[model samples]
Structure formats: C-alpha cells, structure tokens
Target: MTSEIQSYNFNGASLRTLTDGAGEPWFVAKDACDILGMSNPSMAVTALDKDEVAQIDPKDYLGSENRSNQAVNIVSEPGLYKLIMRSRKPEAKEFQRWVTHEVLPQIRKTGGYIPTSESDSDEDIMARAVL
Candidate 1:
C-alpha cells in the first residue's frame, strides 16, 4: 500500500503521520513528543501507566503495571475529523475538556482511532472504549 506522510502543528506541537494499509493518516502522540525532544515525554506515559492522567489508555505502554488501553486511533469521518481539526489548537480550557472528555471518548467508542502500541505489539486485554 502506498502511503503519504505529512506533518502539522497541533496544540503548539508538531505531529507525525502514520498511515494504515489504506493510506489514511493518524498521529502518534508519543512519537510526536519524542520528535519534539520532550525532556519528560515519559512522564506523561508514566502517568498514563499509573492512571493519573484523565481519559488516556494505560495499555499504550507495554510492561506497565496498570496497562489497559494501548492504542489511540484517529477518526477520519468528516464530522469527527472536522471537530478534531478545529480543536487542533484549542484556545479555551472548556473546549479542551469537552474534546478530552466527551468528543474523544465518542471517537474511541466507534473505533475511529488506533492504538499507541508499537507495530505488531499485542495486548492481552484490548483497551475498552470509554463510552
């Protein structure tokens, strides 16, 4: 499958593109963090593993004690895609909360996204949709 990769500025961060067999693009948040040279990108991963972060799947990390959901799939549908695109750089806290709490959960529920797990990585218990 031929795939096209691109980059974009999202929430003051540069994101990387990972495509599926269909060439649809999705961003890997952890990879984005790594590329940005985040000093403590693992901090967020740690929090995710500990369930300290809100709405993130812990299984995204392998061998973490609290591993739960490892993947973070991208939603490609027009409506959901538009919402995510618009919220790329949220200017308000309320909007951020809504996206994190309500909108993202809905997208995950519909399997519109992918996992954060490394390619070919497997999880014993698949992450359950928040909704």
Candidate 2:
C-alpha cells in the first residue's frame, strides 16, 4: 500500500509526517523532538509514562529530500499529543492548536480515528465510534 508522507515546518523547525496503512498520521520522533526543542530526541519516548512508552513505535519514511528512507521512532496520533505536552517551548501550544483545531479534525472527517486521549488507541477510538 502506498503511504502518503510529507514534511512540515512548525515555527521554523522541520518535521515529517506520514499516513500509515491504517490511515494513521505517524509523526517522526526526531523531527518532533527537534521542533519541540528537546535537546535529546531519544528522551521524548523515555520521558513518557510507562504506558505511553508502550504505545509508541517506529516507522521508516523518506526524508525531506527523499535521499533515502530511514527508520525513526514515531508516535501514534495519541502519542503525538503526549510528546507535544513534554515540550516547554511556547511553540508547543501553537503546535497543539493547529493540530487539534485543524490537522486532526480533517483527518477524522475522512473516516479516520482522531485519538482523544492517551488511553484512546486508534483502534479503540474507531471501535467506539462504530458502536
């Protein structure tokens, strides 16, 4: 299946986003940490609660230049928000506004899951919607 991927700039920092087979938007951990102003990108996952840690995973995608694809840790839709919450930078708030008010709502309108909380997995959210 062809996954649609793209690069986006948040407050001058570049990050990559991709839509997985499940139509989930997986955000690159490295780019997310960079944009969020985390000195150590690896800490983004480790800092999370143990449960949040488990929900996170990695996926590969072509870089901005498309030079080659690399495997980078990515967070699920819910994990994306959790990572953003870790950021102390003011841009974190703006980033959250754009994603929640704009990006995610559009994705949901297309029959995709819009994760509402850390406990709400994509599957769980979608399943509840169906009921």
Best by TM-score: 2
Alpha-carbon error at 101 in model 1, in Å?
28
TM-score of 1: 0.26
- Candidate 2 lDDT, 20-88, residue by residue in tens: 676656676777777666777666788665433322223324534444344456666577788887677
Q: For model 1, what is the alpha-carbon lDDT of residue 98?
A: 51
Residue 37 local lDDT, model 2: 66
- Tens digit of per-residue lDDT, candidate 1, span 18-88: 45466555454454334334344434344232212222333532225334455443223232233333333
lDDT of 1: 0.41
> What lDDT would each prediction earn against the true structure?
0.41, 0.64
Winning model by lDDT: 2
Candidate 1 at 124: error in angstroms?
A: 47
How far in Å is the alpha carbon of 116 misplaced in model 2? 24
lDDT of 1 at 3: 34
Model 1 bad stretches (over 4 Å): 1-7, 28-69, 77-80, 85-131
